[model samples]
Target: MPLALRDAFIDLEQYERLCAAAGEGERLEYLDGEVVRMMVGGSTAHHALTRRLDGLIADRLAPGGPCAVFRETMRLEAGTARFYPDVFVACGAGVAPDAETRGVPGATVILEVLSPSTERYDRGRKWLRYQSLPDLRHFALVAQDQCRIEAFHRQAAGWHYELLVGPDAVLRLEAVGVELRLGEVYAVLPALAAGADDRPAQAAFTPAQVASIAAMRGLPVSGEIEALLAELEPDACAAAVAALVAGDGVGGWAAILPERLHARLNARPDDASERG
Candidate 1:
């Protein structure tokens, strides 16, 4: 079934029921009355990065301290919206364990690892919704494929944005008294090959082309594919498609492609060589 049509117009109650009934390995989030499934699984790099960040943040907080760090399974409630940020921290006397609850009511910092499938929503709609949380002070978006992190800090002057690039760059979460080096965040992942230039070149294919490729591969193309691909160079784009055709999946491509597509394509047989 098309993802969009899977669970349309569900309210908070229905969404909660669906989440409760969901099997262990299933992850679902309610967004604008729709239940969106997170990517089936994260890449090794993605998992490693999330773990590293979680550990780093946890280490900074005193044991049984006022703040607690949580992985993706903990949901954050903002109005009627429920979301599972990749990593977040909740602090202060307001924090408490509620057995009947999946919502963290006092989250002060939130982080998300960027994937091709959900980058658009994470950067736009979700970012906006997360800002509505009364206690949210920091939101950081980490790139799984590159040594880049975009940190948004909520200040009395309003929201501030900072782009930290390169492995040596340091990201300071002043709200939580934690600092993360880009290298540490990207540790264990393969180094990103330098493009001819720092800026992403013009995309070699249009949205139609990407959609056609997905259709040919029996994959579903999300709305973010075009923008994600736009960030890659022509060579990287061609290489990614070639990798998919060669049966290596997105693994052989640069990390810029959607992780979900990579996982799906990796499961399929490589027929490009056979057809050739």
Candidate 2:
């Protein structure tokens, strides 16, 4: 059964009290004055990647350094909402301690491993809220099923985006003076076979099938496709692509697919050339 939120808006102190009474291992978050339940379990790939990234950050920072790395259990207070980033770093002075709550006032860097249920909130609402943190220098969104990461960093002009794809690529966190290779980041995960689908069998189409459809439609298969494929079952995946190819439009599929996937497919060039 899914966890249910209490029927009223909650303040930070009340939120902390609810967390304590709920006991350990019950993951929850406060968003827009509502205490929402986070997805309880994560895929093995998500867990592994998070742990590896945490270790990588910790090793780079070392003990008694200016910064420290913390995992998802740590709470972060940003504006009126609270988030438990997959992994984060706090630099200079340590986090302000609260006996009832755990998390830093502001994080130097924040990372989140995308999941099917939370991808929208992570990319949309959470992203907007995170940018407001005064100490945040970088924010990264990692894909669990593919070797890809999108990092956003603050710059003099404004925030800038950098995309890293493929196992050979490296993610450099210049703010914290550490670099991590995609290969290292994805280490220990089951190898995804060439032209094979990484999503569960229930999906409408596999990654390979999506690529084939894209090729037929004269569209290029992109990282966004891979990310979408990670969330869908074989049949639904195939149906979504087919709808786009047939020019019947994505309206019917939008009801069934994630908003992000719908937006990506909609943005593709209509005159795209077939991949050779």
Candidate 3:
């Protein structure tokens, strides 16, 4: 007879206490009741980009606004699960006092910093879960290895995407009343080759490329990848690639260049905006 495997699951209450027990300095999040350790040796590129975002948003909000910016470890719940994102912009004060608090039903924006290990989940399952929230205005995914950002805004009909790359690319956080240049976000990272969408190089993409493209769409990855690529003029693609490759946090510059290159070139830009 096969031995039964124990199911791993941590309820919300226990998840909260475990996090509290770990205390300051250590970062942790709950996933299926498991105390998953977060990447602590944050890439310098990641930190630099995040700092720029913080400064820009904080500055924008300085004019006395009700929104609050919360960074890493302020727990958020979706259904019965809980998660900690890199940063979150909460309107009118933010999440409740404790883990027990279900989070702001009207969350304005939630941001996640992409790491290779978490990329799939971050773009896939996590995004789908986030979309369930009624008041989620925008969802931003920042790539640490590449100078890229994909922002999704909830629209009256559905969600839409906004892609911003390169230092020159302007990132307008209209949902939060702020805008940042891609260059500013990647000001401190190193230069790298842009990533390419995983597709055939010439004669457009083959059937396989088409399938892969479809697969990428099914995942919760920023719809902006498509949006940005569609509108990419020669200058825009060059700028986007430059911005993505500039990040030092990614570290795998050589490895991801081809993919980044493809992504920047072939994808289409989205025009739906916040009105979609």
**Clash pairs of candidate 1?**
none
- Per-model CA lDDT versus the true structure: 0.67, 0.69, 0.55
Q: Between 2 and 3, whose lDDT is larger?
A: 2
lDDT ranking from best to worst? 2, 1, 3
Deviation from truth (RMSD, Å), model 2: 10.6
Per-residue accuracy of model 3 over 1-276 as CA lDDT, tens digit each? 111122476677876676668646566655555556566547776676666676667777646677777666465665655666777777765444354443543457888877766665665556666766666788888877666777776666455556666556776767778777766666656452232323322211222222233343332224543443454444444333332323311322222123544444333343322111
Which prediction has the highest lDDT against the true structure?
2
Write down the worst ten-residue block by lDDT for model 1: 247-256
RMSD after CA superposition, every candidate: 13.4, 10.6, 12.1
lDDT of 2 by residue, 1-276 (tens): 224497787788898787878755777888778787777558888888899899988888756668888889888878778888899987876565445577677888999998877875676557767877888888888887777787777776556566676677888888888888877787756473231334532332366555554444344556655566667665556455444433423233343345657666566543333111
Evaluation by lDDT, superior candidate among 1 and 2? 2
- Candidate 1 per-residue lDDT, tens place, 102-190, comes to 67775899999887777766755676678778989988888776677777777765565666777678988887788888776776564
